[model samples]
Target: MSENKNYQHPDVQKAENDELEIDWMEILRKIIAIRKTLYKAAGVGMVLGIIIALSIPKQYTVTVTLSPEMNGDKASGGLASLASSFLGGGTSSNNDALNVTLAPDIVSSTPFVLDLFDTRVQTLDGKLDTTLVSYLDEQKQPWWGYVKAAPSLAIGAIKSLLTEEADSTAALNPFQLTEKEATKVKGLRQAITANVEKKTAMTTITVTLQDPKVAAIVADSVVAKLQQYIVDYRIKKAKEDCAYLEELYKERQQEYYDAQSKYAHYFDTNRNIAFQSIRAEQERLQNDMSLAYQVYSQVAQQLQVARAKIQEEKPVFAVVEPATIPLYPSGISRKIILIGIIFLTICITGGWKLFGYSYWLKIKKMI
Candidate 1:
């Protein structure tokens, strides 16, 4: 009775400090035991990774690097064709990435992507390819594309997918686009990447294909086609520049003629005192000639630049390191994945041990 009273009395009660002590050796033994039990799951995971790594088809990447033409006046014949137009416009075209930012509302608009269908590729024979007729077939989406989890569903969908794969070629034309050619354009648009280096004339482009040869061909073709596009675009601009400069040059010439004509009339009228006022008149003529010369020099420089651009014969793409087929899979990081699996296994085993401990305590209470 007295012992029981002492245990219940607040004054006699002793406070117990709670502490947890882990036995490292025991924990290690438990972990080893857990691994032995889970050895089958671990083996299954490793096998699955190896199989997945090998099952994926190899894809090759092809790339081209270009040093874009600078907006400079080097008096080169190739650039002279555009100098006038560029000067008139007061600015250059919005760069590749900047196109989206320039018109954000229309960048992702459906009309824009659909409008791409209107552009067609013309072959050397000047006829549209029949391959463009099946453009709508590209819209066939992968099954379970939106459903991320349960990849098996997507695989099942892909097997029976009613999709047409686009065959892109160098002959593809941008002007003769039709409904049939829309799919090819869409596919091309997606597979292509264009990036320009900041504050420099460097541009990089990449294209991917299942066949290594096709990848290389597509990359080279894009480089060729794009050069033509730039040259034509430049030529048109140069003509405009030439026209503007011609008009400005005429205006300056008229002013120069009027200045000369005025000085002549004054000299004839003041012939009696021509020698007396000759110094003042000479100073005035010098100032006018200097101003006229400055304007003529500036306009002449612009005209020369435009002429140079029209004569560019070849596209200039400085090839850095061209892309090659990747030897290792870039999709999966095996070491990182294995480490994650090991961590999860440890958590699950720890939970199981806790569950068993609680069950044993309950059984002892019953006994």
Candidate 2:
């Protein structure tokens, strides 16, 4: 009874026995016996991988990093000035009106990507130079695309026949895209990816294309467009303010000049006169001239400030790493592809050596 009490549970005993009963030596022998099959499978796998790698078009990836001068100081100054105007307080508020974080969203927006369709790129050989849309459409697709997109092809053909003239403006509409536009958009989306890091707040853009030179060109174009877009957006309000101020300043300037002319004419008409009424009228005209001058000076100052604000609000973009045409293509990693195929083939061959014959027998019996 005491020995039985000291004994382990059945499940524990079974597990221990199972651990000892592993047939590693037998498994090794089986593997050795199937060495030739393994070798043949590996060879076939490697050959198949090489064939696939060679068949597929090579791709090149280009990356560019941009750091936007997302300074809250300039934005805050404008926002504070705006808030004070409404709240009747001095322009000292620290709230930032412009959201610097929208950089990533703006870069990835459909309109922005669509704009790049017009960007011109040339092949490294300089033989083919075309817009991004044309390049994408002319690129070679895999054989399976024909089979997979037969329905789409039929629909597009029918639409072309029915419609005499498709509106080009519909291309800009995200929801109602023409067949050509959709293809271009899809290609652009796949080829370009933009992201921002929260830690550093730097925007990283990556472009992948069939040609290295084209990839670099497209990447650089994207950065240029992004900077232009940001600058336009940032200075839009300032520019508007400047225009308004300019008009107001001109009006005030004309009024000031007209007042001066009237005062000067009155003085010329009553030169050396010493009447009390004339003196009173002269003082009144002089006061009017002084008031006009003050108002004109103030408007002129405001106009200058508005112009300065437009310049100050302009965002600066720093290129962390500019896109360069890669010397070596980044696509079709033959070595890795070969290794993966060999590994998969080995697994498949091992299965064949184990249960493949049995499975075939079962299939035969079922038939």
Candidate 3:
């Protein structure tokens, strides 16, 4: 009984409980003990990050905004041309509204991007100038490029041996792109972006490049080219309309002259005759001549209108904001990247000490 009492004593009970319970303070101390190791890992990570960030070339971005001219009731002109007297309202027409709507599609098209590959721009230092395609090909590659370069070289060699063509002339055919030019165009598409606002109908184009001046120049050129493309598309249809109207007018004019000549010949031949048959024939010929004159006049008027509309059909672009030379590089900050890497490294190091060591032990046991 005395032994049992000793075993159940308060001091002994307290000691047993103390042994079973966790010592959070001691665990905290253990974590704090490795603070130097954690900081060293973090410092190493930060140094590596700084090195990587410094190696990457800075890129600059330029943005331009344009408002396409909106014609109220674009289809009204075509409707009027088909039936003007039948449904009389406006004298004007909008035969080329499709060109206005498809403006964005033209900007992002592969052929359009390919065209820009030939565009020339100055480098960051302004000491060197080169084409866009050459610049991208010559500039610094991504970190993973070394891994991909081997496969790319092998594939290129295989393709070259398989391909019979000596040059990329066939690639110039917009429908079939050569592998090299296609790759370049794909990269270019990444650099240029075109967006249109549905409600406001305003277009915004952004160009990103290694050089600030080059970015601005490309963006400005894109806007101008887009406007020109739309104008050309619109003019093509307008010119066709003018040609058809001109041909129709000439045909009608000839018919009118022939009818007038026949009527005059009948009048001169039947001047002294008073027969009912001759008189009826004369009236019919006069009516035919009058109908031909009316058609000729109406067709001549439409020809003039068609010519006038061609001038009106040309697309007008309102430059809301033009691209300007960028003063600063729009790339990720080296300091921020370095600091982030340091912080992540510290957290990982601390976590490894707290929990990863146990996981590693379990993994080792399993192994």
TM-score of 2: 0.81
**Candidate 1: which stretches are off by over 4 Å?**
1-23, 75-190, 239-309, 312-316, 321-367
Which residue pairs collide in model 3, if any? Answer: 77-93
Q: How accurate is candidate 1 locally (lDDT)?
A: 0.52
Ordered from best to worst TM-score, the candidate numbers read 2, 3, 1
For residue 25, model 3's alpha carbon misses the true position, in angstroms, by: 4.3
Q: What does candidate 2's lDDT look like per residue over 172-244, in tens digits?
A: 6765776678777877887888888877779889999998999999999988988888788778887997899
RMSD of every candidate to native, in Å, equals: 12.7, 5.1, 6.1
lDDT of 1 by residue, 280-339 (tens): 886587577667767776766665654554454223445575544434433336566565
lDDT, candidate 3, at 360:
100
* lDDT of residue 164 for candidate 1: 58
Clashes of each: 28, 0, 1
Ranking 1 against 2 by TM-score, winner? 2
